[model samples]
Target: MEQQKFEKMYLMQTVQKTIVILRAFTKEQPKLSLTELNKKTGIGLSSLQRFVATLVYEGFLIRDDRTKQYQLGLSLIHLGKLVEEESSIITIAQPILQQLNKATKESISMSIIDGNERRCIMNIESSYALSARNHVGDTSPLYAGASAKSLLAFLPQEEIDQYLDEVAMEHVTENTVVDREQLLEQLQEIRKQQYVFTRAERIIGACSFSTAIISNGRPVASIAIIIPEARFDEEQFDELRELILHAKFDIEKQLNK
Candidate 1:
């Protein structure tokens, strides 16, 4: 217990140090030398050198050899753009998601790619007492559910191939697809249809209908309606499909604007 506590404190200190090092570079001092950074961050010069070197190696900071100064790197710009896009997507899709949730009285959600996983960025709970439950910030494997597969289906062919080759496919539930070739085939079909409907692939008692939100001919996010299996009506599948697709269209239309 003592060792674990010490390790946790050490990790926290390392993270805080990293944040301080990055914060040392501001508009007033966009470029800083190791000495300047050490002074600004109040870290020892030796420790600061290690942190700055690691940051530079990771592309979070760039060092100018001639001037011996460091500045924020392109990776930070890319991360900033991603943050802006996620915020914009939520703002653009909120009303459409609200309407869809109201129409079906089921849980509605939006997901985006986060590394090799799909992350729920926005979610509206179902109105019914016995509805599917998913929370904002929930994450799931891309091979599992309608919410995940919708985004995965729209990725570039090479990226899709890379992901399939790299990530281990695990069955989240008995119905989850763990076969690579079968999953590839299913993704192809989803691409052709531009939507996916799945049952009990992630959560055991849930069904979801999902479609990608496209911008500039590329998928940026996915929208989903999640329903409890007990509440799902096969007879109403077509109506639910239409509502989800229309929600997709409306959100994408706004995204393209």
Candidate 2:
């Protein structure tokens, strides 16, 4: 019985160390030599080699002979896509997006912050002949659009300040908030209101209203309705905002469940 417990503990330690080694690679450093991986992961060369060999055999990592470095293997891509397809938020939002699009006849988009950028992970295009369009993989500055603002507004003050300080505010359109102080104030207001409405902030002639979906006490994703500015109506805006907010709330409940 004592021997069995010791072996189980050793196996758990090995699993934890393997996870540390795997996490050492990132987008900025996709490939790493054994020496670098050792330094980054704090794992000794001999043990690292054994783990790396097993990982490569299992198709979780690949080695580049010329560079004598390892990179994430292709198998991860398939696993990542599977995770996205089955993600609770995506699964819940899929049917909701279709329903929202049918009711509003407007483009619906869902985005999450990817580093300093907002990545549109899902988009349901409007049925109207002339409508605003954002593709699933489209990326935009986090400071420039309603979809991003909803998420950004809820971040910690220090993070917001750091982001604003680090990111150069580009004038994507005439209506975009180019002044730092004004943008800061707007972010505060957005946090207070729990929503954001932007007109041509990122794309000319396009307007959007967005709200964040909170889960695990943080903004996990955002949903937005984008339409041509010419067709935007002040009276309809309130109604649409409520609908979007309701959808966000429902999705949040499912995510929390």
Candidate 3:
């Protein structure tokens, strides 16, 4: 236990040092040499060298060979743009998602693709005492769940193929589809119908209806309504489907603008 604690503390200190080095560059000093960075961060030259080299290798910093000065890199700009887009998406979708939650009294969510997983970026919980609860930042494999499959289904064919080729599908629940061929067929149907319905795939006793939010003829995210299986009504399915589809349409219209 003592050794583990010491190792963890050491790792954290190393991380703090890295942050300090990155923070040393600012608007007033957008680029810095190794000596300047050491002075600004109070880290020794040898340690600073290792940290800066790692940052440059990871594309978080770039060094000009001629000037021997380092500046923040393009990767930081890409990450900043991603954060901006996610913030914009949540801002644009929240009101519509609230309306959908009010109309159906069910959990409503917006999800986006994050590498090999689907991550919920926005969620409004159901109003009922017994509800299907999924919070923001919840993640599941791309091959499972209505929300996840809907996002996967809308990706370009090449991406879909690459994902299937690389990821090993494992069943999350008894109802989860782990067979690639069956999953492909389901994706085909989802594309043709423009919506996905699933039951107990990720969480037992939960059913979800999902559709993609598209911009510029490509899917940027997905919207889902989750409800308890006990309360699922076939008679009300059409109404619920229409509500989610309308939400998708409204969000997409605003996003495209």
Indicate which candidate wins on lDDT.
3
What lDDT score goes with residue 46 in model 3?
Answer: 88
Number of the predicted model whose TM-score against the real structure is largest:
1
Query: Lowest lDDT 10-mer window, candidate 3?
Result: 212-221
lDDT for 118 in candidate 2 is: 89
On lDDT, the stronger of 1 and 2 is 1
lDDT of model 1, residue 200 = 98
After superposition, the stretches of candidate 1 with alpha carbons farther than 4 Å from their true spots are: none
In candidate 2, what residue range of length 10 has the lowest lDDT sum?
Answer: 77-86
Per-residue error for 143 in candidate 2, Å, reads 0.4
How well is each residue in 1-257 modelled by candidate 2, as lDDT tens digits?
Answer: 99999999999999999889889999999999999999999999999999999999999999999999999888888679546643878999989888999989999999987889888999998989999978888998888889988988888789888998899998888888879889889988988888899988998999999998887666778999999998988889888988898898888878778
- Candidate ranking (TM-score, best to worst): 1, 3, 2
Q: Evaluate residue 118 in candidate 3 and report its C-alpha lDDT on the 0 to 100 scale.
A: 94
What C-alpha lDDT does candidate 1 achieve relative to the native structure? 0.91
In candidate 1, what are the lDDT values of residues 1-257, reduced to their tens digit?
Answer: 99999999999999999999988889988999998987888999988889999999999999999999999998899999888888898998999899998999899999999999999988898899988866888999999999899999988999999999999999899999999999999999999988999999999999999999988767789999999998898999899989999989988878778
Q: All models: lDDT?
A: 0.91, 0.89, 0.93
lDDT, candidate 2, at 229 = 92
